[model samples]
Target: MVVAAVLASGLLLAGPALRRRYPVAWWLLCGFPVVAFRVVHTWRPLMAGCGLAVSRRPALTVVSGLVGKGAPPPQPRVPRRGLIRPTAGGFVLLVRLLPGQVPEHFVKAAPAMAENWQVHAVRVTSWKPGIVRIVASAADPLTDPRIPKQRGPGHLLRVTVGALETGAAWVVDLRRIPHWLIVGATRSGKSTLINALVAGLAPQAVALVGIDCKGGMELSLYEPRLSALATNREQAVRLLAALVDLTLDRMTLCRVARVRNIWGLADKERPVPVVVIVDEIAELFLVASRSEKDEAHAAGTALIRLAQLGAALGVFLVVAGQRVGSDLGPGVTALRAQLGGRVCHRVADPGTAEMALGDLNPDALKAAQAIAPEQAGTAVLASGDGWERARSHLITEAEAEAVAAEYAHLTPVLSELHVEAL
Candidate 1:
């Protein structure tokens, strides 16, 4: 009984402190007391209220002492205010909807609003609980954090999709899993997100290679940091060849060391993981002629190999493209299987959205389609454990750029893949 009292007291004191420190955790922890109350109510009617009252008193007391009652309560969210007046000179305008509004209304109204407002962007922010925000450029200075230049490369990379809601962000420890599939429509912030990832990894002590199919326009920005970049059909194939060879070499290294997971070894002794980012995957598979079948087959096979075996060898792939369809080529389904870490942004069609999120829950697929175009940076991320959750946080281009710039300084030296020539 004495120990129980001590633990209760500690919990009362430390619980609020922990909630304050980790707001996201607070969301999860808030349910505990309610659940306890429910469970206790079934057995001992009076204990539910009594326990809640007792537990809350101490927590409230600590919180009250920390921030006196005179202090204003923290605001959950601020009004969407801007430097320019809502009706004033050119600026981004967004329309938000309250819960239970019709989604069709927003879908129908989006184009007209874009035209009438002369807005560059108009998107539905939410559905079910409907809200919309439209962005228009201002004549004055740009205050948007999504702008790439302000935050630089470091800011753009590795955004916690739940940051705005949770108020805490994390650099998803990718070492735990080996590959990710990044799918979004054109200009749906796919390339910008990739830029952010490269920038995030640039400074890390890891090997980086890129296959830019759009004539290297996307990945070329960080030539200063990239160890290897492949631009066309030939180059992309060659790059994949080199990566496969490198994966084999790493496997041999791991075999000799008698280690499985790299994390099992000491940090200094572990091999540096190689991360390969492929932009515009269609280029590798969309071959026009039968004569090119051999090359396409080789490229597709190499990609599958990387996805299946790369994680064990400490090699990872981040595959991004406008659309991921079986129509794109034969190996699409095979590659998708290996990419367990999946993130889907707003897409042009239900089919594309289905392609990205179909394997998961039916409700999640509905949520993916219902995603408002205005929520471009918003995505649904699923981990490798088969547990999936939807996240509705906006990742601005500027935020990504900022992340990229930060890690650009510590860019690691490029090392050759110790394998036979292709």
Candidate 2:
């Protein structure tokens, strides 16, 4: 008995440390069963308490048909529950909602469910008709997300940057959704995310073109792997125009090959894919004087054209900026519509977050707005599918620079894009 007591006390003392070191193990061995039991035990009452339970009674059965001799009214019917499945960071269950109950009902009750389950958050998503999937995380996955190992070969135009709130990998698949708009304030991990993205793409056989109008302050680190680098607004304009010309050339190639897009062409005949990284996009749009207005307009038109036709012509855009608002120009709004993928980090103003996610998902806008300054890499990303909180893995400038240098030999020489020579 004394030995058992000593062992129990030791485990009690080491519980937190073990949980911190091995969260998945601790959750599976210690937390899952308890949480599972709580979910099953309280589900009925919890549903009824949240007003999700529906009464089963006929309108004609008033006053129980007897003052004191009638049987007690039947309890409300709760939603049917499915098997509770455990995940790496949490658990998921399916619920067949009662009649008149929509997925929105469950979504509205997610906070209550989380509170009762003593979990960090609960997400309710429509799994099928009349069925909703509830995913509950025991803790915040973004606190210290584990980075997945780099594999030998990855899918083309796809990079796994970090982990999502659902504990799944946060991937940016440029092929699936070509253009991206990344907006974040200074030190909010905007640059870090770009570094991770570029580092992931560095080893791939893709032509990287950079237009950093900040005089090569940020993107110059990847100069080794880039086919073209434009530093000033003047050079950016020339480089963008050159890219437009290159796309037109590719379009002609596709037309002659009888292919719809570049991807449909034979691999041997396909031109190397081009990824344009535009850092500080506001620099290309903001006009200082009347003389620069036409220059800004030209830059904006070039970007809009790229965003319109780049995805089909083997050119993709990753546009990042500290601040992006409609007040910048109507061109900003037009460009925003073309970029389907948005990652909004902690922004200095609500307008940036709105510009990034408002049209896509209002809830995502709220989530992005809630990102604290301390949560640097944490962002709210939204596409046509939905929105979720995610964090990008940290990739320092030196690491990105090294990766660029390591893949310098793979850089495709596109003579047409040599803006410096032009």
Candidate 3:
């Protein structure tokens, strides 16, 4: 321990680069003994605040043994015998799994841990097979947004959202999941998320499509970047129908060329990849008038078909809704099934949270529903993997418009297809 401490101190005192390069070793050596012996016993009150430990059993001291009983035992020291890691946002309590305690036990006690640790929040995840790691944040990292860069594969999508509670940068790769479901309340930063996606994807070699059923108030400004935009039920139906036709054409093109998907085709022969963003998805199913019911159904069916088969043929979906529920109408549930990636912000009800999280640990649902108004851009996101707390960058309408104008020339003309609709 002395040697490690000496080496760590020397290296860290020597240079910043060395400290950055060997941070883990430095922190482990510099912190282990000090934290384990010096701080553990002193923080007894704070440790027990999480209700994870019991008071120490009173020892039969000489006076106690003689008197048959004594006043009481001193408080128990915390049993967190492991490493103390100073991460970006706060500290990580990493310990080997105890005999009867699982990672869930710590996770279940996160709220208390956060309060006792005097942190903004806390999350517990299994670092490895037999390790439990509790990450606590001194400040809410989501409050500080992260701007995404326009780089990555033409087909592969990566959007830099917010940071994790551990202060690690959070990004979602749409190529891996192919589609996403974003559920949030009206002021829950759904528009900001779409802006982030557009900002990142505009400069890439892909086509952007928008279905802004809210009278195009959300996405019409990006007309310079979007290959197509649908604002009403009739327009949406025609636009989705055209996309369906385009998807079928791509499939036939792939078969004729003896390839499986768009990626398998030679770059020169491939068509432009497509990413469709649907804002206020509930509007498509709201059929206000009896005369428009058929159009609404057709639009929903076409959109569902796109979700079902678009991924393999160089297409992706980013569907957002204020409230995603069965009450939205028929086919809502089926359409949701295709969305492998899920992002949930502060929802008005528990069911919206449930639809976004879907059988995830109940903790995630609770977390989503519990999102306070102070954290507008923050959200709970789940994909094929697990979930994380994320936030979209503050890309306003003006910034998005500038980006669209900058990349407007790159927007290709689809002469063969009806450009007015799709």
Candidate 4:
């Protein structure tokens, strides 16, 4: 008995350290069963308490009493619950909503459910018609996310940059979503995300083109792997025009080959993919003179064109900036529409968050705006599917530069995109 008591006390003392260091293991071993039992035990009362239960008709009760003497009255029907499944950091269950109950009802009740379950938070999402998925995390996974290192060359154009709020890897697949807009203020992890992305793409066969209008200060680190780099608005306009011509060339090749997209062509015949990384996009639109204005117009038009046709022609865009608002011009808005994927970190202005996620999901905009200034790299990303909170992995400039140098030999040279000549 003494030995057992000592062991129990030791485990009690070590519980928090274990939870902090190995969250997934601790959750599975100690958290899941208790939460699962709570879910099952309190389900009926919880649903009724949340006003999700539908009461039986009083007239039916009377009729039943008369027809079958002393029969019990029917009880309110609660939504059917599915088996609770455990995730790395959470538990998920499906609820077949009662008649007149929508997912919104569950969403509205999520806070209360979390309070009762003693979990960090609960999210309700529509799984399908008449069914809602309730996911409850035992603790916030984003406080310190652990991302596994890449073992080998990852899938083409897909990079696991960080961890999502759900404790899943946050993957940025350029092919799945062709273009992206990443907005964050200084030291808000905007530059860090770009570093992570470029580092991931460095070893791939794809060509990396950079238009860092801030005199190439940010992108020059990867010069070893970059096929082209533009330092100023004038050079950016010329480089973008060259990219448009390159896309047209690919389009003509596809036409001649009778293929709708470059991917449809034979691997040997397909052109190498091009990924354009535009830093400080506001610089491209912020003009003070007629020449700069013309240059800005030209740059924006080229970008819009690229965003429209880039996906099909094996070209992708990752446009990042500190501030992007409609005030920049109508072109900024137009470009935002085409860039289906958006990642908004902590910003100085509400307009940037609105512009990033307003059209897709208002809830996402609120979440983005709620990002604390101290939460570097924490962002709310939205696409056609939905939105979620994520944080990019920290890849310092030196690491990214080393990755670029390691794969410099794989850089594909495109003479037409040579900005040095321009």
Give per-candidate clash totals.
41, 0, 0, 0
Which regions of candidate 2 fall more than 4 Å away from where they truly are?
1-18, 58-62, 65-70
Clashes of 3: 0
User: Which pairs of residues have clashing backbones in candidate 2?
Assistant: none
Candidate 4 structure quality by residue, lDDT tens digits, 1-422 = 99988866876788799887887877886778788999888988998899988877778776878688977667778999988999999988998987788898898899999999999989888999999988888887788888989866689999989998888999999999999999999999999999989988887889999999999999999998999999999899999999999999999999999999999999999999999999999999998999888999999999999999999999999999999999999999999999999999999999999999999998899999999989998999999998889999999878988998899999998999999876
Q: Give the residue spans of candidate 3 off by over 4 A.
A: 1-82, 127-129, 146-156, 289-291, 416-422
The models' CA-based lDDT, in order, is 0.58, 0.92, 0.75, 0.92
Worst 10 contiguous positions by lDDT, candidate 1: 138-147
TM-score of each: 0.59, 0.94, 0.79, 0.93
lDDT of model 3 at residue 335?
Answer: 86
**Which candidate has the highest TM-score of all?**
2
Task: For candidate 4, give the lDDT.
Answer: 0.92
Q: After superposition, how far is residue 86 of candidate 2 from its true place, in Å?
A: 1.2
Model 1: per-residue lDDT, tens digit, 1-422?
Answer: 99988866776677778655653344344423443333233322222222211232355665785677565433222122222223222223233432334444555555454444444333333322434443332221111222222232343223332321112232345666568887888756566566655655665667677788789887767655566777776777777877788778777777777888665677787766678888888778887788577677878899999998887777788998878888877698889878877777777767766666787545457656666766655555565343232333343556545644655655555455321233
- Ordered from best to worst TM-score, the candidate numbers read 2, 4, 3, 1
RMSD of each: 17.1, 2.6, 5.9, 2.9
lDDT of 3 by residue, 1-422 (tens): 99988876786586465435644454454433444344355445655665555545455564475466655455554546466667644676776654556778777777776665456777788888778777766666676643335455344466665566556776767678888999889889888888878877887788898888888999987989888888776777778888898899999999999988888999899988889899988888887788678877787898789998898898899999899888877678888888888889998888888877866556678778879977888888876556788877778888989989999987866643344634
Per-residue lDDT of 390 in model 2: 91
Model 2 residue 338 CA deviation (Å) reads 0.5
